[model samples]
Target: MAIPRQQLLVVSEELDEAELAALKFLSLEHIPMRKLETVREAVDFFHVLQEKGMIEAENLSFLKELLYRICRIDLLEAQLGSSREEMESELQLPGRAKVSAYRYLLFQLSEDITEDKLKSFKVFLGKELPKCKLNSKTTMLDVFIEMEKKGILGEDNLSVLKNLCREINVSLLRRIEEYELNLSGREEVLIPEEQKGSTGGPKAQARGQALSVASDSPGHWDESSWLEVYKMTSQPRGVCVILNNHSFAKARAAVPKPKDLKDRPGTHVDAVALRRVFQKLHFTVAEHRDLMADEIRKIVDIYRCKDHKARDCFVCCILSHGKKGIVYGVDGEEVPIQELTTAFTEQNCPSLAGKPKVFFVQACQGNACHKGVTVETDSGQQDSSIETDTRLQLDYIPAEADFLLGMATLQDFISYRSPRRGTWYIQALCQHLEYSCPRGEDILTILTAVNQEVSRKSCNKVEKQMPEPGFTLTKKLIFPVS
Candidate 1:
């Protein structure tokens, strides 16, 4: 039997350059370095695997494993006819994995290495690798390949890589150390299996005892259990600070003719919704109305100075007029969104480190209105007219980990509002939280639902609004409903 060439071609077309490089990197152990170097496209790499007998119609386990390892679950299911659950179960059997754990570790390191770190790595290895391979466009994956060719990095060798990571970023060294520990544990588990039925020495008996304990515990070897989740079980989960700027009278008075900042009338509805939902979720809600830009900074600093060691998370909702990278205060002053978010960084607020800090901003990112595309709807009814918050700007979230900034709309687009009803983004967000939190849905999943609901809505049959959620969360954040 032969695998369908058309299916491979279609899947190949879906892969971008980075994904192609990832697939090739994962295949280094199975295919020769020379063949992989010549394989530039995904289809060509698949052909090399097919020729090497690693993938065929009857045997596609290796190909499926490659796709699964690269986190391409979509392609694994749609094209390869294999699900993640099936792959997980199959890989549980020892020696079924074609990709070594060491290889996967290196690939993950490459993925996480920043561009600046990559340049540093190239400079450090300048004397070791060929000068031609260390160009400006060289990625971490390419650097890893060069190191492997130099015989410094391999399945059993990671000293050079560890030293490089230690110099570049101390935090990254933890990954390599964890990989080494897990690799050692796997070796201990395999000793008993390989030397079964022998009168093993004292060391062998101890290994057997360790294996017995591991076998008894179902989650002992479960890799997914290694992932740490944000602890959200505190009595009062955290504080929910709502900065509602409904009266912008001072802004209107200070700004000149064309740039008049109007009062936000319907924002109270959003504030009420947020307060109710977060309070129901057991957060201590603090609602501040009509604040100046300086006042906003002071309030955030007050919260930042608070002892949040017992808290599991923090939440802030800013409802005001905003421009690119800033929100306007009631007094017509600009407050940088980055400044507000960075106030809670680990350095400034050590008590809140490793906890999720969520910010939801309901304001126009810019003056430009988003035009809607025609879509078939089941409802025959239509809204004749709708209102909008005329304020405008873009958004900003800090680069640090464990922060999430949910914007009302994309940059340069005006978000919708109603004189009676709240904003399209905030209302939808509250609705999703109210519905999904009790069901144990994570924050990102809830935000995606908000995005879908808000994008479907249109004002005056032409203007549409799409919410955006940017995050650097390192774990699944599920709000406690009780």
Candidate 2:
């Protein structure tokens, strides 16, 4: 049965901006980002949910959960004919809730984060998201939406959230840890019992014999073997393409005065660090410098077209100026980040399908500067100065899996650089890779370390930066150093 329009209208009329935003955030997994962005009112959002088959007259469970999640108990009781206690009991059943525990946890965290920490959180994620998404009026719910769009924050992928919470408030990390533990416990409890074959049949006896023979064989798989990880053991582990755009002479002439990009003097430091690290990890590093937008695409196409059947993975690093959703070419043209990533999809680059395609972008996502929080410590402070790659700029993985995108900073924020030492993000990334990869750590763990390390550092003792990593990998990706 279809839900009556009048009832939806009545409930929609009761929703304010805060409640509406909460509903949208909770519905992110159900509705597409583009469609959700166009929804101007609660009624419109409900319509979209209905269109997606998420809400109906008979299936009002999702709506009830949404109202419950937002703590609109009055609406739940009056409109949905459900109460908070009923929802609590219903949600306790296995797989009963529509909104994931992870999503609910984020919403709860958003509600709990203080205004000052919220400001700090926005600054930390400034470069990984779009400028419009992180304005002065942006809320924690808004930040989580952008993070989901970037594929950084999700039910399964919570490293970025965990890192952010650890930096902002160590206490919050406990919540995530508990959630993970609970998930593990549930998985263990949900394991199915093996089905028995017919008691006195020849087929059943044959099946038992076959099972006995298979178990006796040396090749027989164990329970531990079920936990599969990606194979990163290929020699010269695929191609590592580094598009290092250091000079921007053509950009200065092509772009207007205010948007004129400066030459990245210390980019070579990053290039050298990346080359050394990847070389140590036994990768064939192909470095290109000062490429235009078209040229950048062509270079990626060249790698994408390569027959990478012999390779275990692919890596591409872009170092340049950018704004939200785009990176600037040396000649002042724009390259949509999505274009480069989608080019290597299973349909586009068949040879690299099923293999991890890692992209580490070292560019500004926007022009916002991250303000650092003052820490009270007994140690005396030393004077220091830092330069920022503050030019405003702009996830390629969509249906296709096995991709990781590590951004220098959150969207709309500036990432710092040193004329001599190299950019904070790239340098920290290389350092962590060098240390962690050799110790058998996976790529996600290494990126988390990078996030922690970069978030702790401040330029001029007032400005800070945080790196954001997003991935759709199906298995653990550990680089073999030897």
Candidate 3:
């Protein structure tokens, strides 16, 4: 049994003497203070953190203001192992940037963040803050506090918040100083009547800039103002091409089915489920069954020629037998994944340039099968593209970014198929997509949940399987909320 526990790690944007003293008083782990210039920089930082542990940090929703400052999805995805869609989903949180900005406003408005002003802020929150499918939670401060409970936030997040505020506006520096000096000695929300106006502090007032965005109720905080930028929402979205290769010619004895696979009935189930899922996403689902490896290339070439200028993304699924780094066709020949992806690379196919191109492969990557190990319970965890060939080098990055490959099982492992249901990976993926997408989840996030779900199932007593998604998506790829 996995023991549920609270772990501590101090995160700070800056830890001056006073903040350092607070750390001593709090008795929490004091992590090194670091600053991020890019999401990749953060990724580097997290990698350093992973040396200490797995670096499985919770979603840093509070720092979205900082992300907005950077607004680089590659960095976010690189650091968090998330897709652009995943981070954007988090960025839209109600108080992502607003709460911190509201604090700055409070410092400036010492006496002006009146109940009336606060109401105006609420109106702003409803309008500017991207509505998370969350339970109407608002503000970075609230999210930060929740993280602190999980021991996810510490001085590091605070330091980052302070730094983010300063980057957003210089006036924040003065407001922060005032906030730290609040005689209350306790962290209290700035009140209008209780605090005297900034009439006594002219220099602070002189440096202060007016906050144009609305904020949380009074001391409450909410969305981005300066750094919150929205990713382009595709006009017609995109289409899904599911190439499910279930049956091979009996004469092609070299491509024999697993003894119990039961004539590929589950694959049909997968095709049906996936079609419905993508159709609900308002995507045109094109299903091609029993294609040869070369034929697969032709289909991608055709898609590349189609006018996808209006589409936001693309999807392709391969359901068949496979080998390491390769999937098999109905003809029993191998198709290197690198070949499948390169067909639509920006260099080869400009139509999908910079757009998310996701490939879902429900084939075994290796002959290894999971011998059911003891299942571990996660107390509260949660959780594309292509190019074409000329024998694309798997060691090299895709010419274009924003591509993803979701593998059914780990490298060299066999993926399980249920005759009554379908492949474990596809079923879990479809189920999780339905459960999470409407909740503002991006593709990567839904896949993570799918990974968690599939990883836990018992294939045959002790046999187990796990699905993992790999991507270089530069932006978030979210299906339209249904």
Candidate 4:
């Protein structure tokens, strides 16, 4: 049987001559799975099938093929370089970024889980869970339950999610289905997925059951498949606080001012460059020069009091001298890095709950340097509510989930700065972010690439520096330039 005339007309208009010919032959031959032309076309074709209730057991294989093809197309496009404006407009689509507000609820399920495990779970969500998007409102089991009850999940959505759960531990999914969370605003407006995963007729259900695959391992999914799994919008615009401490004096300053005449705080090369970069990514860059420890906390605290409900995420960068676990203020007083980070937790800063809080620290974690060996193996905070709040001191919570810390250097090594080029870590970071962020890379993946690039560099008389990232994020944090 031919595709409905109306659907065929739309498909023909969208597909080029070659794609149209291929579709016609496939329709005649009754082949279910084959490589398609464009991601845009594949998605459209799938929609037409779902609408017509023609998604059968045969179509499942086609579904897998289409998803993988979409990934390849996306990766190919990312590797291609168009004009800056053209690239941003084309890549950073709205609703593409994932920021789960119910992250606190997810945290409740496993207070004991490690960061590495959290990262793996995030990968599963982004890659395995089809038609599943997370945001600030997902705090309880009811969201999923309610969707199922209301007949919002289609056969295709169920098949994919079931496969996802089977591939992973699925304990997380169970906890989500069983555990209830104590959170404010449990009920919020939700969108209707009428086009795809909405309630289907009995005919569609029969088609889905026939096509169900029993295999547990993720099929046709590999590293390259991630290209379709993650879509970042550079539009998570909000406050980007820069605490650049450049000057210092007697009493052996804690974070010494930049000694490099060209790269020092006064030159503001890193600061300026960072501003341009974040602005390009849609953040409102707020630069604070030479802040004392208390001053830095106070500024971030003030931001905490303001409403971040309108913003998609928060970013704070500290550039200064440092040792072991803290960075020094211009006055030489050290502020515990943990203190700056815990202030934005969901319990502490309700306004930012479920949104990303990103911190990039540019300081030496310790007084040592790194030396790279050949044939290398690679491996890969904010503020406030200080003072009267007394919350952090009592609870001692680390930065909440959805927070990312991209340190300038691995802990305990002095980060290098040139008299002109700027600090090695931030410069490399800024460079990669400029190139990668607009292309829709997740923050950690982007940081990993930055680490790889910086590790190859030699600064401070050929001493090596490495950038490290510490994250409690439960979902992929994509920075698609707005």
Candidate 5:
């Protein structure tokens, strides 16, 4: 009746002191399931049993009892903080922050599904299914297959499940089985008193059978769980192209200059800041300082080829004086926004097909800026992308996913810039990112702050304009992980 020395040693070595005491308490005196230390430890203990092939029916029952005990521990923890330590002084497990942290870690660990796969799963859940019900004892595979037939699960569903399994730790999949068994309660049957010892082996075998379930389980999720969703940080790797067509074919051409122009076209802050920020971000930025629309499209096409396999994300920032829907190329040719964005449709760029493709435009969409009401309306901030008359034209493929276009101003407006400094939008954007991007804040949040600061500081400048930010992020993005 003595436990094996190796098993005892393994258990002792693997578990912390509290877990060891809990195990001893369980084995020696049938301690309450709630008396253990951490549910994570309990999970680990169950895993050890599984590895030892000791997952008996009674053990599974023990697991269920333990989980409920832990659930109560969680409830208690939710109600109180370190008070669990006081509970532990009386020999009960504390479940508050401990459980919260575990759940959050679990969700982050489980985020292996692609954004599209997530979308598909949501659609399947929302749609009615006459065939499959949660109450049925159908396998998860069966439910998935049925959904696949009903056009619910796309071709990528298998990959999603595989990735999810990998991310959540395949061991947890087995743990999930034990959790299911824990829900079933004790399984009592007719047995002779003398044969009771024989039951342990069968109980272990039964527990092993309970691992794979068909549907989602509604477990308690706390704020930690919410935080877990932010763990995923995969960003698209699209090419960023900046084309400034405002310059002459020759940098020093004697063209019709704006009335107060001092610096020539090539030395604009828009070009300099664009290059500096993109290079810092480690993007393979391509710049065509004065290319026509065709040349720009040609460069884009080179990167768009899937066979060549360029990158996953795409960005294009155009800097020039422009008419509505058209950015001025070097030769003053009009490059329509639709023409620029069209090169990145799903058909042309399959690698970025469902990935985030961001476009930043700095051009006059129209010509409606009148003389200012007051010459000194400036609040001492730099000028912004000018607001103009013509609206920007955005043509996107109906089904293409994850595209974001950040325009300097609203549609049909000129973006402003100073010859000495950079464009208002670029300067503010860089300033905000340099200062506020390190706090694990979302890109949108930082941009909003940037917009407010820019608006407040520059509303009274001569070319008075406000920087605008627009995005189509499929999910949240936090930059500079370090």
Candidate 6:
């Protein structure tokens, strides 16, 4: 019943004047424009795009980025219906001053950016520019063009990106809601049909039994047990805690107030998608909304106090506002990362013992804003961290387990947020979890997907935050793809 197609080719040459103008706003140095061969296919693909939740526009630049961005208009539409006046007021407000303010604050924190170096940064912020398109075959440029065609660069209209970041950052207080969700219950992983054969069933049962015994055994075993027994099935336990923190009561003063931060429908759309995906994979997700650090310490303390009975693996998702190694409490206080995870340390909570402890922090790490990256012929040439202080202090701590740390951005840097939607890191994390978790994708595989999605879907200086994962697992995990 499905049409069979092969050697699918898509070329983007029918770019009209406006599209062409949009292209000039782009950095096309690395795009492989000459290799494309199917302009017709690309045009046709753009035609029915709206049916798949695409936004119908006389212009097709937006959808050139991701299938997900199309759903954003539905977000816009819902906002229109809820409060037209508020939406109009925001849209009409002057964003230049606010943008300048954010830029100033960021500049004060780090000298990695400047006005003279903001051309590429402006491109990421979605500023309008002349007509242009790719003129080469560089990988970075190629990826950027691909995203531009998908319209994933998003609307920089009225400085929406800054507003979005402010709005989403406020939702970090919702971490409490995540904790409640985790306390309520967790989804169970289902057995696959193919593995239902008699031999397979017994084999799986035996393996499960063996895993249980090994997981329950005490540490400090002889070298043989470490290699033969523990190494056979030892793994870091996975914990998912979704916390909601702070309130919009003290919202950012950015003009064009973010739609999602105002409780828009698309708020946390990406994060919810990921939670559901991970839930289906039997991840113990603690979905809390609006929790404070004192509360965070208390909850982690409870887990630490009961480490003997605590889960061997750990995954903590802190969805809150942050600066550098510190996240904001609902009271506007700073809570250091060391303070939060100290509960999991051997000195505090020894239950986790020698397992994997993973923390996925989805908040701005600092006030440092996105600066234009120097595009080089090799994409790998870009420095991973703009500042020497980018890596978290946890990197230096002698963690008991193979602790893995995942943060939204580098040091002294603010992660990108979607005014009414979720933070970029959270959204990407959730999407990858949904797409790959249920399929039994390994932790690394899912993280890879998250990295690719964020890198591909976003650009510009301020919005170009990526999720960085540091791990120390004894063995590789493949999430058991079914």
- Against the hidden true structure, what lDDT does model 3 obtain? 0.50
TM-score to native of every candidate shown: 0.49, 0.49, 0.47, 0.46, 0.43, 0.44
Could you list the CA RMSD of all candidates, in the order they appear?
A: 25.1, 24.4, 24.1, 22.6, 24.4, 21.8
Q: List residue ranges in candidate 2 displaced over 4 A.
A: 1-226, 255-259, 370-395
What lDDT tens digits, residue by residue, belong to model 1 across residues 298-392?
99999999999999999999988775567878887888888999999999999999899999988755444222321111000121122233232
lDDT of 5 by residue, 1-482 (tens): 43334443443354464333333233312332343323345445555554544445333323323323333345234322223454445333432212222222223323333445444443444333453342234333333434445533332122223223433446644443343233222221110000111111111000111111111221212322343212223332335677765544432242563221112232256676667666555566778766755776676677666432444456677765554456554554456766667677778766666556667766544333333221111011122333332323343222455666655554433344544444556656655554444434555655564454344333222233444454445555445534
The digit string of per-residue lDDT tens for model 2 on 300-352 reads 98988899999998999998877655787888788988899999999999998
Give the TM-score comparing model 5 with the true structure, all chains together: 0.43
For candidate 2, which ten residues in a row score worst on lDDT? 202-211
Name the 10 consecutive residues with the lowest summed lDDT in model 6.
202-211
Query: Whose TM-score is higher: candidate 5's or candidate 6's?
Result: 6
Better of 4 and 5 by TM-score: 4
Candidate 2 similarity to native, TM-score: 0.49
By summed lDDT, the worst window of 10 consecutive residues in model 3 runs over 376-385
- Candidate 4: stretches off by over 4 Å: 1-236, 250-267, 369-399, 460-462
Q: lDDT tens string, model 6, 55-155?
A: 24333223322211112233234322223333445434554111222222222212332333333333443322222432222222233344445433332
Clash count of each predicted structure: 5, 18, 36, 11, 24, 69
Superposition error at 396 for model 3 (Å): 9.1
